[model samples]
Target: MVTPDLTTSVAGIDFKNPILTASGTFGYGLEFTDFLDLNRLGGLVTKGLSAKPRKGNPPARVVETPAGMLNAIGLQNIGVPVFLEEKLPKLRAYDTKVIANVFGATEVAYVEACEMLGEAEGVAGIELNVSCPNTEEGGMIFGTDPAALGHVIRICREATKLPLIVKLSPNVTDIQLMARCARDAGADAISLVNTFVGMAIDVERRRPVLANVCGGLSGPAIRPLAVWMTWQVHQAVEIPIIGIGGIMNARDVVEFLLAGASAVQVGTASFVTPSASANIVTELEDWLSERKITSVRELIGGLELPPRG
Candidate 1:
């Protein structure tokens, strides 16, 4: 009887399943419709949206490293108004959960993005990208400071009625404080950890490989750190946690759920396999059925680690 079709509700918004595509990695939900059925996903978190269109960082903004990738995409996105006018209609037709990713260079920009999304139709919820570290002034790099995190969340809180999921950074000294701040500031849910800030050298050129020099690190290399952070934050706060980073297969998905995440975001994996979400979702279902579980929700944080002898 165990079925992957178990429904999950986070912050009052319901998801058909818990597996979803991370923002930036998955373009507007419509873009993937040709490659894969839009309805197969548990949810779709769209690319980051700003108050205004962004050109993003200059050339050579992404560099491939062994095991991980560095990205300084700078939250490049079309402005909120355009998304509302153009993308929202096409997205609204999809059968999956519709989560919008909002970003800003300033608290005001954050508020504006949310306020706009709030007014748009068919958008299920909002994911606050307050901690992205790639921007010059506002990206989440500032959120490592609790006061700033609180301020940014509160600002967005004032602008919308949709469920708010605050995304946190991994670069902070105490990730818990940031997660707590978001919850305390009225966030309905929390997601972590965003890419770790990292850089690489060209060696041959004697300079950084990426033109931005520094970017967020993602992939299997940061999976342990991400799981640790997710568990810690889930224990510290009352809001639901959506774990991200290095999710390559079914076991990794189970690890995140056992680590206390109510949901998981699959990022980089989608780059090579556009159908990655479909496979992960199916694998999760098969694992649950084989384990004799009747519902996928039963797997949420169902881990019991061995005691120290």
Candidate 2:
């Protein structure tokens, strides 16, 4: 069988494959070096960077659930300046794209972080983690409010020439509205369904399991919901959509592509298997070749819908 073409592009950046390691889970794309060949994968999204370093939340930040995991890491990172000065230079040796995942506590902080990443070398693009709270707006999250989301995207758009991708939060009434808002505000692409807010109680102790009281839910538990939202956003916006949620293997990646994602990010699965993303890349090629598919791009929005009466 011939080699199936797995190359795909999002926001004008070409990826060898649609598989990218999600931020926060991949640990700056350097820690996984021993586990997998970074070049074999399409790209890697760095942990969420802020203007200043963060200590993150207290202990008991992670807990296992039915078919997924919950994390309240509090967007911890070594800050944008440190990553650019240190981690990025090492990543330059890899052939894959390095997309920086940025977040801020306020609009100004967002702009500052974006500006810093945009000027750095070996950086492919910026993925804005708008799930953060806008401290200036009474703690309202930038991803949940359309206006706040648009405002942040617009300013960040001005902050850099890099391709901007808004990571949308699923804790909203309508995800499509937020996608449109990000698009209208100059986002080159949008990554959906960041993480659903959830709480796990100890029951026996009558207390919350996570120290932060609540955490982001990820893994297979949210795949169905994420796929549905991806399809919804695909119909709502014309820009590229990078589907992110609980993607475990090649089949899950195909599900997102058919649902209208130009690409997909591997998040929670990385914690379970460090080589999951790289393994999926090979499996995806084999999957396509077996079906006589020429290119993976053919699967984008390939979902067949039943006719509406």
Candidate 3:
């Protein structure tokens, strides 16, 4: 079988492939070591980490929907100090690239979080989770307003030399405007469709299924919308775009790449299969090889649009 080259560069950081474990879905990337070779995949994005340890939201935080899942985990994490002192050392031993997913309620909090990750060794990049719908104050607030989004991006840009990948929120009127804002503010790259706001209820009890009442919806249910949004952002910005939101198999990854995504993140699928990310990497290679494609780059933004009427 012909070996197709899967390595791709995003925001100056070179990844072995375009597959990355989405933040929040994959714990610290080390948890799955027993299930899959951590280095066999592209990269690992740590769960959303805050300036300080967060207790997260109350119990009953997750619920299964029709074709997706809703989660209001509230960015629960071990905080930066513990992550650097404990997780970083172990992650550095692996050959895979590690990207820290940072979040905060205030601009200072965001800057501080990035600054902490910036000083940590073995971190290939930083993915600002500015659109987390689970948070009470910050999260989506920093991602919705153009001015506020620009402000946060600008602040974090100065806080870290690591590739700054701004993960965007889908809960907005114009995601294109926000994409442009991140690019104009000096973001190295951007990831999109952080999970659409959704909710579920126990009809018999007349109460919300999730303790938070509302949470972010993810999985196949949002793939179509995610692809559309990724395409729109691709048209609006120049920086590398990492597509997120219901990607499941190798074919789904191709759809995102055709829509102009430099890479793609697998989230909810990980919950279904521990080795989903690594398996997708293999599937992608096989698919490319079968078509005599030498590299994944050829398919990036290669979607052929129908001629205008």
Candidate 4:
């Protein structure tokens, strides 16, 4: 019997499999130690980090929706120094790939964060969370503006030798333009669509449900939109893409890969079941084996579109 190959290389880094835990969803990659063997997974993306530790938003930061959930965690993290000093040593013990998710309020901050992560020993790659607002640009998110996004990526590129993956926001008008801009700026890969801005109100209390008022939405609700955007960006650029949004199971991962994602990230699903990522990895292999597929890579960009009338 042939063993189905799940290995995939993105931005020059080899992944044991195509299923990785998305940033901000997998915590620091150590929290799930009790739930599943971290070594069994493909890779893990850490929570977004900054130069300084953050307290995050006020309570009521998370609220459950019908088919999804909204969160305004404000990118709370232990900062880079602590991560390097405390977390990295522990994360290094795992056989799985560890990619640090970096974010900042300014382009300089982004560069600095990337430089710090680049020098870190345990990290396999650096994922730039360009979804944060560019404080120097009058509070516009870097991912929302192609020029600004390009500038940030260029500076970060100069700052790090580690493979760079830019996480794009879905709030923008044209995701393809932004993906192209990142590629032009020397990005090795791309990940999208970072949670869509959404809100829920408490009519009974006549107030916003979340403390942050508006927050990023995730879960099964956004799967279709994510697949669509991933397909659009796939058509627009040649760089590898890490599809994310609402991946909940093996089927969801297949949809993204078929739509042209080289890999897929499991986010909200982890929140429901801590072992979701590890489970999906096994499920993917099983699904492929059942279909007589020898390699998961064969599913990449395999979607067949109908002829135009």
Candidate 5:
């Protein structure tokens, strides 16, 4: 039997293990009970929730690219009211850190959502999805603006006392500015590379694959990018980082750790295997046992840069 040092912390939330279910892929935390031991994993970031329920984009909302996939989920959710009244009450029974992943088209909406989560019981923390484009001000606003990012975080910060996680968008020219913006705005932690903007085409039909025209790209293709962003952000900020993007197994987890991620979040991998996160936890246990590695934190920023000959 392998006993891995499963305890991991990020955004002030303690995880049972470093293995976690990423948002959007895992649905709500309750969906994984049949496929996983929720308590065995690190924690769960629930599906992106907004101020109101959304039906999401049209049916062709997702499409596969060369080595990744593009998605425009439109942040579909059951709204804050539904989540608090119907969903959060159920999540309280589970023995794990319950993170509320929230989004909105406006700052007021975000504040309201955070306030609602703050009042709700059983919530361990709040993960802000500020990457969403502002609906009223046109699509160019929100995530890309440093000032806008700061406003959103500050409003939410004042609204609640829960640990805040500001998810960054990878579509910016200078991610460091955005990371610093979040850090300066009182965020406890940051999640990097919230999907690169991309789109695919249906060859025969000669039309855009996804009805949204453009969608966020994720999966193996963006792995290297994610690592680089995590490393850069790690060097710039003191807050813990949650490395996501193309993490499929223990090896990937170790890679993220070396890249300066405090812990790892499994996203697209969950779709391929409902039990992928737990399997990764097992594999990590086996790897650590065989190597006699005591704690996973020892591996953080452990990567050695190549010598310039």
Candidate 6:
């Protein structure tokens, strides 16, 4: 039998495979060189980059939950200029694609970061971390408000010629509306279910587990919701979708594909096993070959449903 093909294209960029490491969990991609060959995976998204470096939140920023974890790291990073000057050059040596994740507290900040990354080399695309709050708008999250979401995407869309992928926030009443907003505003592709808003408490101390009081929830816990949103967004827009949630193995990756994702990102799983993303790339190939699946693309939106009674 011929080897299964895992290659996929999103937002006009060709990926060797469908598995790219999620932003914060994967660090700068160079950090994992000792654990796995970076060239083996489809791509890697750098930590959230802003116009300037941030000190992030104080201590107690993360906590492990039942089947997942909650984090409010405050999008800390070395800033856009520093990443371009220091990291991008080193990453250019690897054969894999490098996607930069951009974050901002306001619309202007978003555009600034996009412009900076747009001028840099070795970046295949820009994934907008719109899940951030819009300080200019009284802290309204750009991803939750349809109008705000569209505005930020439109300006950033104009700021960069590279592919623009808007990562959606799940804490909203209408996810499909948000997806449509992203597409109509000129997003090249969409990545869904950034993280569910959640919080944990210490019964004895009677205080929030994370210093930020509330944090984003990620892991297998959000997989079902993520898949459902992926399917909903698939029906809402024509652009490609990169599904994200509790994907621990190839089967989980297959679940998102069947639901309507051209590709998927591995987030929390990387924390459990540094090589989780690379392992999934190989496991996905093995999974398809065992079933005689010629190309992984065949699984996209292949979910079957019962006919109406």
TM-score of 5: 0.94
Going through the candidates in the order shown, the clash numbers are 3, 0, 0, 0, 0, 0
Candidate 1's C-alpha runs over 4 A off are 1-5
For candidate 3, the TM-score is 0.98
Each model's lDDT comes to 0.84, 0.89, 0.92, 0.88, 0.82, 0.90
List where candidate 5 sits over 4 angstroms from the true fold: 133-140
Model 1 RMSD vs true structure: 1.3
- lDDT per residue for candidate 6 within 1-309, as digits (tens), equals 789999999999999999999988999999999999999989899888888897787869889998999988877789999999999999999999899999788899989989988757799999999874212221237888899999999999999999999999888999899999999999999998788888899989999988788888999999999999999999999999999999999999999999999999999999999999999999999999999999999999999999989
Candidate with better TM-score, 1 vs 6:
6
Better of 1 and 6 by lDDT: 6
Worst 10 residues of 3 by lDDT: 130-139
Score candidate 4 by TM-score against the native.
0.97
Q: What lDDT score is found at residue 74 in candidate 6?
A: 77
Candidate 5 lDDT: 0.82
Residue 95's C-alpha lDDT in candidate 6? 91
**Tens digits of per-residue lDDT for model 3 on 36-78?**
9988879999999988998889989998899999999988899
Q: State in Å the error of residue 152, model 6.
A: 0.5
How much is 292 displaced in model 5, in angstroms? 1.3
Q: Across residues 105-181, which tens digit of lDDT does each residue of candidate 4 receive?
A: 78788777887776678899998888742122211378888888999899999999999999998889899999999
True-vs-predicted CA distance for residue 294, candidate 4, Å: 0.6
